[model samples]
Target: MLFLNRADAGRRLATRLTGFAGPDTIVLGLPRGGVPVALEVARALGAPLDVVVVRKLGSPLNPEYALGAIGAGGVRVVDTDAMRALGVTAREIDSTEVRERAELERRTVRFRGTRAELDLAGKTAIVVDDGIATGSTARAACLIVREMGASRIVLAVPVAPRDWIARIGGAADEFVCLETPAHFFAVGQWYADFTQTTDEEVSAALATTRVT
Candidate 1:
């Protein structure tokens, strides 16, 4: 609970990531809420900025609970423990994934009208998000970039629980976070001015900046 807004959070996180600045560094921003924060980091790091889409495969019983996540072009991540604990069947998981895949396609169209995915091969990629609540979506993003052959992947976020952050520490080559408090709540609670990011806002952020 240390940030006033997404912009402020990005600046603080960017400061901590100063060591990784270089020509081959690529910034991949998760859209919806993460774009604003990612914009700041991309600017500060002087790296290429791009968006990586990941849709949540919500549980059939509790739609809000993310049992897994799916990335564009069909990459997927499922929490096997959660699925078993909730008694989620393969059919349900498949159905949810289908729905999320369509949603991810829609987002891709909205965010990138005619733009293509940034080249990540042989580059040091920094994946950015506003914060980590479940970390499922962020993890999915990291996997997608890694598949694209990023030399090193750094998962960066403004705030997250220490436990969740530790879980992802080994997944990425580097992990940069500003606040990892024990009293973790929703990512919004940590921000004084957390707001829903609109499709228009996402498009505008990408259009105005030359990072990508």
Candidate 2:
């Protein structure tokens, strides 16, 4: 089974999420990729949309493997063990957090424009992403939303490794991932047209969500 892209993956994921929609429910996208998927889910659910900004605090060298992630309002979630494995100093982590914090603010200004953020407190919030590789970013997002007082959190990802899903267990009130295969090669592997989700596409999806 393969997906066309984020939008197609989203529509499919939305079916599973039908059980979670209501007046007190909302959809939050992890942007630069998750926006398109979240937009479709928001449209299907008739819920308000917002971005939960979380940028990975990467290793000093690789930078792809996330050592942690920084979210809105100066909140940071770290993987202390990962840091130790990489021999990352506290100073390095602090520096990366500062940089990621700035990126989060920039994305907020770009994606939000002048719109006020939706209050997520006491809501059944579904935090979404294209897929999970390391799951660090998603885990961080879950924590940040919890801080916002979300009544229950449902993490909706199109695909993720079973182990990654297990790692995030109970962080969300109910976790909904469409696929968790053993091979778990990559998100692209399960997709037929897993093209890059560009920033322009993300912005357009966000615009559509605003008035939907």
Clashing pairs in 1: none
- TM per candidate comes to 0.86, 0.87
Where does model 2 exceed 4 Å of error? 59-67, 79-90
| Candidate 1 error regions (>4 Å) | 59-68, 77-90
Q: Can you list the residue pairs that collide in candidate 2?
A: none
Writing each residue's lDDT as its tens digit, candidate 2 over 1-212 gives 57888889999999999888789988999986888889889999988788888788889998878777777767777779989988999999998887778878988778777777778878899999989887877887898888778989999999999887677766677778888888887778888777777777766777776643
Give all candidates' CA lDDT scores.
0.83, 0.83
